[model samples]
Target: MSPNLFFQIKILANITELRSLIIVKQLLNSTFLYIGTFS
Candidate 1:
């Protein structure tokens, strides 16, 4: 594959990784909040 195509794929992978991380963080925060409320 070309260098430009490789670079674009790398960027897309990074963005997807970042989005997943944010979603995980949000889920954890909400879970903690829910537990705190119950206890």
Candidate 2:
């Protein structure tokens, strides 16, 4: 494989990881809020 292709794939992987982290954080925040409201 070419260096350029590898670099692109690495970047894509990082972006995907970052997006999933953001989503998980949002979900956690919402869950905490719900618990706080009811308890």
lDDT of the candidates, in the order given: 1.00, 1.00
Clash pairs detected, candidate 2: none
Question: Clash number for every model?
Answer: 0, 0
Model 1's TM-score against the true structure? 0.98
In candidate 1, stretches whose alpha carbon ends up further than 4 angstroms from where it belongs are: none
Model 2 TM-score is 0.98
Q: Write model 1 residue lDDT over 1-39, tens digit each, in one string.
A: 999999999999999999999999999999999999999
Tell me model 2's lDDT, rounded to 2 decimals: 1.00
What are the per-residue Cα lDDT tens digits for candidate 2 across 1-39?
Answer: 999999999999999999999999999999999999999
**Number of the top TM-score candidate:** 2
Note each model's CA RMSD in angstroms.
Answer: 0.3, 0.2
